[model samples]
Target chain A: MIGRVMDAGPGEPPIWVMRRRATAWTTPQRRYYQLVAALPPLRDFRRTRVLPMSQRRLEERLALLHPEDLADLRMAVSLVSWRRQPINRTTAEIAAMYEECMAATRNRALRSTVEFRMNVRTVMVALRLKRLGRGVPSGRWGVGNYTRTIESRWTDPEFGLAAVFPWIPEARVFLDQGDATGLESLLMGLLWTKLSQVADRHPFGFEQVFAFAFKWDILHRWLSYDAQKARRRFDKLVLEATSEYQDIFA
Target chain B: MESLVLTTGWMGIFSPLALGAIGSMIGVGRGGLAAAGAMLEVEAGYGRFVGVAAMPSSQTIYGIVVMLTLNRPVSVANSPGLFVLGVLTGVALLISALAQGTACAASISASKSKAEVFGISIAPAAVIEGFAVFVFVFALVLAGSIPR
Candidate 1:
């Protein structure tokens, strides 16, 4: 997605809104961003291979990595340096899972500042969940019947989304005929797809949250500093990406 | 073609269809995302890899109980509407299955992204699956029960 970042144009609200969501990442999330930004997809190397790696071969490759490789993967997750010991890439995947969630919840209004800001909060909530390890209690337990033990609480921190987000005054409501359950599922699905786009291209050592956040902040700052001038630049990126994907996905 | 909606929507689920608009709003997984860039698809992918997989099968379970309680006997010969209902519900189940499959795809896709595995492209694959489920459940509910 960042491949086209140099190309995002302010004329297109879609790219601008995405840029906003991209801006809300925590320092760690942005670190992963820069690492991804500074690299391109592994496909550059894959083109040399005649046959694609099989599922088993791929799994073996992932499982085969040594401890150093694990550390390299961690380097991509956040700025903190840990042992270069190898661990499965699966650990970092949880956040990478929901990359393009904002795309799925698309609404004309959400593309606007006020509504998308709500989405940013929701994303932050999700990030908090990412921090909390699974199998822990969210506190509601038997009463509200939470599936996970309150992965991370904010909606009442005392309550849940059931008690909070639904009624938040500033929250922008998107019209979805699907149940809340289905909505969650859809957001997750899209996130994985987008994250995969960036993750697959870049190496494990390069991904980081703080770095990307900084870059996003930089662009955001640039945009804020010179809205008229940056708008021209932003439009260039979007027009170019639109043209690129037109050739690709088209 | 029309059933009574059966039992005031037990557990507040009026089938995936009745809650169609709402399900797309509150659920935790990308089972219903419309495209590859969809939010649910992304979340589901990440959710699965960390073993933080979201709720699955509960809706179907509730759906079954609701079906049995309100439209008992699985009758094929008597109610013409049964056929349509079965077909429709089948579509819903199929859509639900689609969401599940995307979740599965997301699980693997998560690995693909991490391992830098190429060739297997990632897509906001939840929508197509939803379409299937939508059709399958419709068939299931409407099957042999046209409510003559």
Candidate 2:
């Protein structure tokens, strides 16, 4: 989550796509593999990884790569063999880089994946936004940078919730009616925002906040639906905080 | 020697002045000065917790002794006062815990420590502990004045 999307935004030149015989796996494929890895007892889907043709193509392209590494590639991509090295090398270049990189690492390479998106538009937008930052060498005079920061982007914070939107056949169990995506977007986004804020203010994250609240068993009381109760809960929490100050701060 | 202890409605509650004494000797006092220093170091992203943790342990020991001398074999199940005292003891422990936790977080932020990423905050943990102390002190004073 922190790696690719968080730093980049709406306007940047599109990332030049090389279209690897394997350039990079699309975002969906990466997410799919990631989800598959996490969902245990789903071994049936795991067997389809070995692709041999891509393996040979990768081997031919990167002359220094080993055959066992090539065998591993076949298993990773589920390919039969490499009929054309240069013809498919653009995509395979991405694959080869990953395979070579993995072989160097101690971590066992189970899946070969890369950024599915080559968003030149997002790049251009980010660059445009960056351009807004520079008024002079002294880094003075630019009102546009502030505007760029608050500017809304399409693939915003709720991307995770959005991805799960279609798959959730029923809505009632998790959410209250009325545009679950919008609400989930709002709620989860709010939660993510709160989580981020609390994490920022304190030395922890929302998950930790949840655990702390879970320990107290009514963390939701701090922000429950009943406004009065939530307020009282907040008050109690605040008084408690003040008392803590009295303990150390006093 | 004159008794420095104070009374409230005919009950002698532990004094904040005494708190300073107790805290100084056992709970975050001279013994904990090193730890306090360590705690501050954590916010700067360093690991000096050996000393930081020491302060609270000393303070907790003081609480344990203070309550134990006033009451014997303190347990939450048996001694209502001590149970509350135990809560207070837990709170006092958190001052050190807070320092240590913060130091640990700083260390983590600096990539000097591995444990900070979980981000389970110590502030609430300390607050939760403070309630125990408050209840303990209340019970101590209330029990003395009230008749069974």
Candidate 3:
């Protein structure tokens, strides 16, 4: 899958293609002033207890996007989303998906945003592999530009890229201590910061919209982890299950 | 060459109105789109959004006044002055209107979410308008000395 993705076609690199397409099609001149203004500001994920905008409302607002942009955004989201991957999907399939997403995304900011998330995922994978005392497997085990560096520098504590990724040491500590929740929180915080910067740099533009959507996703995911809510949902499910059995016995 | 310069003077005299109108059209369009979008999310206070959208319209008025002020006979002497002043004023108004429209759209979008910020959010647009007024006032004052 990695070989297929790398040699998909002969032409410009994906990054260069993305840059050229972005300049030609996704110039900042196309402002969504009304759409942007209509959406509410998203609070930081860590600080947000309740999502300011519901998923339905967000979808409704997103409907205002140009059809092409909406399509691009959907494709990008599917690729970069932190949602659990399907159990059956092979690593090669995931790699192919990432390649497809990068090729199709026309916006530079959006493409780079996806790249950033993928790089983070790659780094996390490397860390996990290291923690497991495993050697870097051949072929594309991860995405982004750092795959080669990670493979070669697998023994380095920070994979010899500590300066590039300042949070590696902290993330390493979390991983070492088996602090899964802490590591997740740190990763989300890093992405949140990146999205915030993107939104700030491109206010009232497509980049801002993409950033908001991703940030909203993060906030929604964080808020759904309430123990009380989970307990209530668990109880409701159990009650429903028991009621079915009761009816059968009756 | 002389005819061309005079013709340029005439073009300059009308440039403000034409350019200012174009700027206002875009500016107002931006603000109006934001206002309309905000209306979907909001229940009341729609009037204020419309009012904010109209902020960019002031540039057109300034353009009209500049056009009138620069409306003197087009001679070689006054042609240069008219051309310089009219074209420059139009450009300024055009840019300011475009910028203010963006500011107004931002204000409307922000204020719609947090009602408290409605008043304060417009400060940036107001500041941009202040700059437009400076261009307007100075253009008028300078028009008096343009070999009219």
TM-score of chain B of each: 0.34, 0.30, 0.97
Tens-digit per-residue lDDT, A32-126, candidate 1: 21122122122221122222233343333334334433333333323211112246643224223222323332222212221222233334344
Q: Which TM-score value belongs to model 3?
A: 0.90
Instruction: Give the per-residue lDDT of model 2 (tens digit) for A1-250.
Output: 0112211245752222222213344322111111111111111111323221232432333232234433443443232111223554443344344334333322121221211111211222233333456221212111112213323331332222334333222332233344533433333233333333433443322222221222121222222234566688999999999999999965
Can you list each candidate's DockQ? 0.01, 0.01, 0.77
Highest TM-score among the candidates is held by which one?
Answer: 3
lDDT of each: 0.35, 0.32, 0.86
Model 3 pairs in collision: none
lDDT of 2 by residue, B78-110 (tens): 344433444444445444444443433332233
Query: Candidate order by DockQ, highest to lowest?
Result: 3, 1, 2
Give RMSD to native, each candidate: 24.4, 27.3, 4.0
Task: For residue A249, give model 3's deviation from the true position in Å.
Answer: 20
Output the lDDT of residue A164, model 2.
30
Q: Which CAPRI category fits model 3?
A: medium
Off by over 4 Å in 2: A1-250, B1-58, B73-100, B103-148
lDDT winner: 3
Error of 2 at A170 (Å): 40
